[model samples]
Target: MELRDDQPMQHEIGNRTYIVADVDPLDVDGVRTVEVGSALWLLGFLALLPFYGELEANGRVWWLWACLAGFGLGLFGLEYCRRRRKARAERDGLDHG
Candidate 1:
C-alpha cells in the first residue's frame, strides 16, 4: 500500500510530495441518506401540490411530477441499498437471520 514518488497520483508542489491518503471507503450503505432524500422529494411534491394551478398556468407543472418521480425512485434505491447492507452484514457473520 506504500506509494512511491514516481506513482501517477504523487504530486510535487514546492518540493513537497503529496500522495493519496490510504483509507478504506465508508460502508454505511447509504440507506439513511436515501430515506432522507425520498422524504424531501415527497415533501416537495406535497408543498407544490397547492400551487398546481399556478404551475400548470406557467408551464412548470413538470416540477411537481419530477419530485414525485424522484421520491418513487428513491424508494427503490432505499430498498436496494438496505438489501445490499443486510447481505453484506450476513455474509460477514455480523448479523444472523
Candidate 2:
C-alpha cells in the first residue's frame, strides 16, 4: 500500500489497524505525566525541608536530594519530548509540503 502524505500513516497487523501521526496521543499524555511528576517531586522536597536536619541525622538525607534529582530529570525529559515532537511536526510539514 502506498503511504499518502495527506493522510495519517497506518499499519495493519492481523485484524487490527493502527494510525500513526506526527502528534501521538500517548506522547501528549506522557508529557503531561512528566510535568505532574516533576511538580510533585519539587513540592515533596520543599515539604520535607523542615525535617532535613532530622533526616540527615538519621542518615536518610538522600530522600531530599533524590526528589530534587527526580524533579530536574523530569523537567529535562519534558523539554526533550516537546522539542522532539515539534521537530517531528516540522519535518512532517516539510515532507508533505
Winning candidate number (lDDT): 1
lDDT score of residue 27 within candidate 2: 34
Query: Each candidate: what lDDT?
Result: 0.91, 0.82
Per-candidate total of colliding backbone pairs:
0, 0
- The CA-based lDDT of model 2 is what? 0.82
After aligning candidate 2 to the native by TM-score, how far in Å is the CA of 37 from where it should be?
1.0
Measured with C-alpha atoms, the lDDT of residue 60 in candidate 1 is 100
Top model number, TM-score: 1
lDDT of 2 by residue, 1-97 (tens): 8755587478899999988767633434266778898999999899889999999999999999999999999999899877776777687684311
Candidate 1 ranges with C-alpha deviation above 4 Å: 1-11, 19-24
For model 2, what is the error of residue 60's alpha carbon versus the real structure, in angstroms, after optimal superposition? 0.5
TM-scores of all candidate predictions against the true structure = 0.76, 0.63
